[model samples]
Target: MRKIDAADARLLEAVQQDAHLTAEQLGAACGLSPTAALKRLKRLRADGIIEREAALVSPRALGYAIMAVVMVTLDREDRGVIDRFKQDIRNTPQITSGYYITGDADFILTIVARDMDEYDDFTREFFYDRHPTKTFKTCVVMSAVKTNGALPVHDLAQSAI
Candidate 1:
């Protein structure tokens, strides 16, 4: 990965917060001309500094009232088992995010469902029958305090420099 300068970092901050920001607005936010901002934007996209911009959809609004954090421990940690598990996560649309974390659990997943029964069904389909998931723990979210995944680009850049 390439290092980002101050202006580039500022532009990233603004764009991540709101992808709809025009060249003029981004330039104003980052103290650059519209032309300069546009140029930087193109470079950022080309360099993969800025990945695809996507809308943050709410699962609650779409009748997915159940949100769960599932910590899974597989019986075996072989390459085949792990690959199959990862593929399973990708195939499952209800599993929004999956992380191979460094902890007691082999994998962590963010799962959404319409209700309790749906979530139970998900566990049976995903864990019980599919993978060699030895044990899995579920933590139902009572409240989502913070969900917007905006990075602190400007601050990180300042510290890095």
Candidate 2:
């Protein structure tokens, strides 16, 4: 695994909380000057430590208020089937997140839709109609308790040492 220092950890944590923070702000937060902060950030990006930066748009605001978590089981675990399913998940805009998981299910998916009808259509087209999918269960989210993607950088930095 790649190693990172305490200052790097601080910068990552701070930037995750607010990606728009200026170099000066990040520097002040992480005990580095603006130039040093910029350099470190550049190195981090060049090293692929920082992935894509994006704004988190609300589903409700976008008129896609319905969200569901689905667990899926496949009929076969062959490489071709898995790859095709993964490709479908990647291409489908409604499927916000998909994971090839263990235990009772083969895959877990988080989907968003404008309403129940759209969600049903998604299930019918993506799960029911898909050849690889044997069975699937869905849990429509009533309310989201939290939706943050901040990593525990403090713990990560400590563990690296």
Candidates in order have lDDT scores of 0.90, 0.87
Off by over 4 Å in 2: 158-161
- Per-residue CA lDDT of model 2 for 5-53, tens digit only, reads 8888988988888889997999997789989988988888889999878
TM-score for candidate 1, residues paired by index: 0.94
lDDT of prediction 2: 0.87
**Model 2 clash pairs?**
none
Error at 144, model 2, angstroms: 1.5
Can you tell me which runs of candidate 1 are displaced by over 4 Å? 158-161
* Residue-by-residue lDDT tens digits, candidate 1, 1-161: 78787888888989988999988999997889999998999999999888788999988899999999999999999999999999989988999999988889999999999999999998998899888889999999998888878888875565231
Candidate 2's clash total is 0
